[model samples]
Target chain A: MRLLLVEDTQDLAVVLLKHLRQSGHTVDHAPTLKLAGGLWSSEKDAYDLIILDIELPDGLGTSLLKEVRASDVAVGVLVLTARSQIEDKVYLLDVGADDYLTKPFSLDELDARLRAVKRRHISKPVVTQSVGPLSYDPTNRTVWIGSDQLQLRSQELKLFESLIDSNGWSASKEYLFDRLYGLDQDASANAIEVHVSRLRGKLVDHGLEIEAVRGYGYRLRYRLDE
Target chain B: MNDLWSIRRRLFASWFLMLILVSVVVYWSANVVVERSLREGQDRNLQAVAQVILDSAVKIDTVIEFELPYQAFEVLAYSAPERIYYAVSVDTQHLSGYRDLPRPEASVNAFGALYRGEPTRFYVGSKPIFPGSTERLRVVVGQTETSYQTESTTIAVWIAVAVLVAFTLLALWAEFSLRHALKPVIEIENDLGSRAAGDFTPIIRQVPSEVARLVQTLNRTFDKHRGLLEENRAFIAQATHQIKTPIAAILTRAELLEKEVEERSRDSVKDLIVRARYASKLATQVLLRATITYREIVGVREQFDLTTLVSSVLRTMDPSAEIKEVGLTLLSPEDTPVVLDGDRIAIREAITCLIDNAIEYTPALSDIEIEVYETDNEACVSVMDRGPGFTIDIAQLSGFDTSKKDPSHVGLGLAIIERVAKSHGGRLTISSREGGGSQCVLSFAVS
Candidate 1:
């Protein structure tokens, strides 16, 4: 995950930067809110999360947070506040902060918060989702059973992706074929059935079922035993 | 002086004493004037009778002839029953009744005479027979003072009654007016009494000018007190942030170094990290406790849900529990929330301390249950941990004493919990739970 840490304290920031880098994350450090804002806007698309310190040398980190949220960027913001006053925390949470940590927080705790924020971001797409042991990642076009990616042909992957987008509703064969192949490519209606059969075999042990709606297409549902 | 401490009593006593003094002075002067008037009236009556006797005297053929004026004596008898006498004399010869009656001295025209052991008022009058007849007749009349004494006593009694009436009215007026005058002081006392404990808000109500001074003094003290508290709170917050930041960096840096160091040096670095973390924790708890104490002095409270607070705290602690492989769970009633009135920050800190202690002591992968529910008209939060149960009696734990069954775990957490619970009209109970564990319960009344 890529992160921006906005902190004025140099030593604390260095330690946090070292820990984040050692934990296999790309982190950028900003010693002041002005620099933080500049870096955030110039590289807005590059960051997946922001660890914001409320007490900044130039401006309140919350203002920067507000600017980020106003720009409608889908990045997670985790606030760090020195004072644990509940009202301020509640206000920060209300204003689109994903999470907050009080001062003197452990590096492990910071990592955990980063993971939770990322998970929340992932859950927001609604189309790509994970339930029990089944996960569908839309960005990478992969379906994961537990930690292992399910092996599927390109056409089967497209068909399964269309079913997940249907969100528990049946996907018609015409819709599945349109999604599976581009306009230049031609596919027969029976081809959707072949991909569905093969995907069902692969999903046998996973906690999911590809249910056929008679005369229409297939929908994905969790297996009841799970 | 002691008697004057009560405003009501002092006002009444002074008013009563003043009324009595004025009444006595007025009564005494009035009695003296009445006595003088009565005596002058009796003397005038006696002089009239002597003139009548002198008018009746006449000299004929070398001897003076006279008739006693009985009508004058009859008029004197009307005031009260009393004896009367008269005498006529020319050249020291007594020629009329009651010759033993005393004569007036050469320089005195009227005098008192005692006759038959009864006191009498007398007057002497002399008249020439004709303008130049060379013969002078003197007459003296005397009367007992029974009627004069009776009239004086009656008048004195009337004066006494008037003074008594005046005193009574003054006393009643003093009692009612004094109470009305001291009403503002009572109001101040009542205002102070009804305030919440430790509340330092100024006295804003209007008061009498005299009592206004007291109110102003109190308000000044409250302002100073609030100022001091605000400064103290700001310092604590700033100090804690400053202290915690460096300590956090040290611990994190040491941890980072621990990973890169060789195996033999890694252990020592790990120990350094632990000590740094412990130092940071102590600083946080001590400062947080100070913050709580200042807030308690300010005495602000609001109503909130203990269930919601407990659940939120548990969620915050979830990551920490995961690091230790400990499962922290909250059990609460679904329908009724554990709603209570208190300072939310203090309560949260107390609960945090309890759960933090449990997490530190309990072995990894052990379960710690935080149960919040209402029972026996009380809202309770009980943290049960699968740590080694208390070796010493739980009731014997003291906040000041560092000595404990587990030397590493001083009783600071327990002490803070107990203090908060007691301040909130709640109770803290530490007991060894069934089947090998310890439970600490903080409870407050529902209503």
Candidate 2:
């Protein structure tokens, strides 16, 4: 993925740029809003995501974000700010930001958010995604292990889709339930547990596994050797 | 504070007292004028009868003889129903008519005396029997004064009563006018009474000139308060930005260094990252506390459902809880929405703090249960964690206290929860769960 990072603080910017590069993302760093605007105009269509800092030395990064959005560029914008006030977060999101991260965020979390923002903003229509011997087609809603389609109930398929959307991050049980039953449905509290247990059994043989994060929920990942 | 002596009551009392005084003065003056005139009419009648008798006298060789007029006495009878007496005399010598009638003094023409067991008025007249004659014949007439006295009293009382009724009606009209004049002030009071807290909008309603100054001062005060709150909000936002940016930079740097450093030195680098993260959290919490306190001072309140608020807080805390591998569960009455009236932001922060604390303390793969319930008069959100329960007496913990068991745990979370609960006329309680772990309940009054 290609990203544009607009931040003024040099100490933080250097580490973030290094971490982002190590995570296999191609990044261009700009320490001021003026430089960021220049980069955005020059390579506006080349970037998949823009990591913006709200406070910059020259001017606010929001101005550059607005410019990028106004040009109708299909680039994901993830706002990074030290302002954790709910109003600021809401305002940033309301102003066309795909996602936001408060300062002092974990590198792993930042990478996850970047992927999530890219998925939301820039649509790359892939037919199938694979994990080792397992392959799933999102368009057809089918899973195959060595050319044999895995059988799953409608609820189980929905749970699988929710976990897949998490992008290797854990999806909470409440979130999974909401995805499965929707807002107005009447279902048992343990309905998610039953579906997850059944899905776990089918995925284990395909070099893919569903791991229950005890206090959280479930994450779908490649199976590790025991 | 003297509620009984309101402006209306005071004005009415003063007017009432003045009216009574004027009524008494008017009645007394009217009585005096009426009695004097009536008495004068009686005296004229008496003098007329006396003059006729004096004119009827015939002088025979220096001796005077007079004939009493019957018609003149009858005229006095026609004026009012009262007894009358008359006498004709020369130097105290009785001529005709009642011999026992009281004579006037030698120099006085009219007088009052008791006659026939009743108060009476007497009149006297005298003239010489012939021209320049020194010997004068005197005539005296008397009548009882009961009828004229009664007539004067009746007239004075009726006049006084009429004046009293008219003044009383005037007083009532004045009271009605006063209330109508003050209608705007009452409207202002009602407008203020119905306002929601934190609303500092100035009163712009039209008012009478008499009350305009008061309303203007009130509007100025509202403007001043609105400006101060706005400044406070801006300051909190600025301080959050100024304080946390560098901390984030430091934490990110420490995290990076932890990976590059040798295994033997990795623990120290990890500690550096933890401390930086803690500092960042502390700064955020402190700013949040200030914001909540400011809102409390302004008394911002709204109605919201407890279940919905808890659900949102759980969602917000999900990522952090996920990183810790802690499972979150919500238990609430199905189809029932527990509603409470309070500062929604403050309450949301409080619930977030509790869940955050639970996630921090509970081990990985443990579960945190959040329940929303309502009692008879309170709406409660309780967070239960399958972690080591409180070791010390919960009552000893202050908002800023550092936990003895966990050095890294500052008690700001509990402090925030306590502050929110108290501001809502609610309470925060920490108790051991039935089987294990800890339960923290934050409850607010339903009102």
Candidate 3:
């Protein structure tokens, strides 16, 4: 995936750039709207996704988003904002953003959101996987096995969904550290261990194959071919 | 000022007391002088009356040649009051002309201190009369001095009334005039009291010379601060937008880099470049906040020369100055050294930021002229450059922080300079060269 990134903090940008590149994607970073406009205009379909900051040194992301929409461009956009309220999220999403990620977000969570957005429109089919009758719904949260509805908390469901939604790459504890808990939360790499143990127990009783990353987080492994 | 109230109260009290004292003294001296003159005049008239009666007896004794009539002298004494007495010391027993004289011991001695063994002061103009040459009669006529003392007491009462009237009028006038003159000060105090609560209203008053200039400056200062507050509010909005831009860029780029890593594309080299751009923006924001906070504090002042201060700032930034090849020079030749009374550290920071701005904005190897001079009782420090100049009239607006909106000109530096200038009773002038570049000048009252 290709994206347009507009950030101004050096330390934060360096760390974010490292983690996001490690996650796997292409990013064209424009420090200002002026540069971003030039890049956007220079190459049609140069970006598969537009990751814009609402406040640019030169201008706002709303205009950029409007421009993207007016140009009939089909690129998915993920807005980054410091604001963490539901209204800002809704506002950005309404203003042509495919998704919204607030600041201090985990790299893995950001990666997951990107992948989810990428899965929306593609040359290939949307892959929906399951763990036994503990079926997973990426768009919804209910999972059932053996005619019995599974009861799981929101974070537990998120942990399972993250592992299954890794698109087959092994999910690691370090990756889950950034996802399961808020990056600004008082959580560590061990936080995944606590959540994964709970999730694996529920799925194993239902005859699912959820594997550990061995000193890392967990991964859900189940196929119908068996 | 702490003692000023007490001082005024003392003046008020003393003025009332002294007026009363002065009036009393004037009335006292006048009463004493006038009464003495009146008593002398009354004594002279009484002596003339006794001489006339004796003259009538002496002429009759010389003409008729009969025994000079003692009856006539007696009748003269009878006509006068009983307090009057006439005594004749003769060859016979004392021929008297007294109805009843006050006893010699009781009477004030007519001859005073000289009368003990001496003749009685020639009667103070003696009227020694003859009774057909057989005896001599001294017609000493005087009312007892009790009635005279009573007259003097009445004169003193009049002086007391006059003095009372004078002081009462004076007190009324002094208090009335003082209150009227100070009414403006009271109004100023009321206005200042409200302004103390951050009202920022212009004072409406005309006070005495001592307080007039002070009140005017206070109102002007309020207006100045109010204007700056308004500007700061605008600057805050502008700053929020500026800060948000970089934060948003970092966020959006972070998400973008994730996408690049997920695909494992050979062209993922582009992701690192994207992140570096946002990293520099972070630096910009940190500097921006530092400058804003440095400017925001209510600045203080002390005496310091700009030459030494600017040199130190430049020395710390020498490497950067060298990198830009912008020569920084401090050219000042005045014993009238620039005296600044402002927040030394904050002002130094402001100056350094400005110098840094000049160094960064100017073209490489271009001359950056920094000079300090004394002008119009003010110390002026100017940093001129051959780089791109400001677009608008920054000096005229008196409040426009800066016209340049370059990534480097976050406008924070310009705002700080303006704020510091105002604190030191001065202004910042930013004028463009006719051809190119800008001249940024910071003015301060030469303390």
User: Which has the greatest TM-score?
Assistant: 1
Instruction: Give per-residue CA lDDT, model 2, range B1-447, as digits (tens).
Output: 797798878888899899989899979987998889999998998889888888898889866777778899899899999898887888767777788877556668988888778989998888876789787888888889999999998888988999999988988898889889979988998989876455576788889898999999998898798779768777977887887888888888887788889999999988887777777777777777767766775667888888988886765555566555466778785468998998887898889888988998886556788999999999999999988887655455445756554545766778888878877888889899887889999999886
In angstroms, the error of model 2 at B269 is 6.7
Per-residue lDDT tens digits of candidate 1, residues B1-447? Answer: 585677677766787787778777766777788867877887888888888878777778777788877788888887558788777887577777777778666667777767688877888888787678666787878788866767776787688778878788878887788779778888888888976566687888989888889899998998898889879777877887777777767877887888789998998887787777666666666666666667777776889999998987786676677556566777675445888988887888789888988998887656798899878778899999989865544465445446554333545667777767766878888788888789989987766
Q: List each candidate's DockQ score.
A: 0.16, 0.25, 0.03
**Tens digits of lDDT, candidate 3, A34-116:** 88888889864778887777766788787888888888667878777654332344467668887766554445446656654
Query: How does each model score on lDDT?
Result: 0.77, 0.80, 0.59
| Number of the top-ranking candidate, with lDDT as the measure | 2
Please identify model 2 stretches exceeding 4 Å from their true place: A18-26, A45-48, A104-226, B1-5, B37-124, B127-137, B140-158, B194-198, B204-217, B254-317, B327-447
Interface RMSD to the true structure, each candidate: 9.8, 5.2, 17.9
Colliding residue pairs in candidate 1:
none
Candidate 1 regions off by >4 Å? A84-96, A124-226, B1-4, B55-78, B81-88, B97-122, B129-136, B142-165, B194-198, B206-217, B257-275, B293-303, B334-347, B357-447
lDDT of 2 at B248: 82
How do the predictions measure up, each by TM-score? 0.73, 0.67, 0.39
The lowest-lDDT stretch of 10 consecutive residues in candidate 3 chain A is: A119-128
* Candidates sorted by lDDT, best first: 2, 1, 3
Q: What is the TM-score of chain B alone in each candidate?
A: 0.77, 0.66, 0.41
The alpha-carbon interface RMSD of model 1 comes to: 9.8
Per-residue error (Å), model 3, residue B138: 9.4
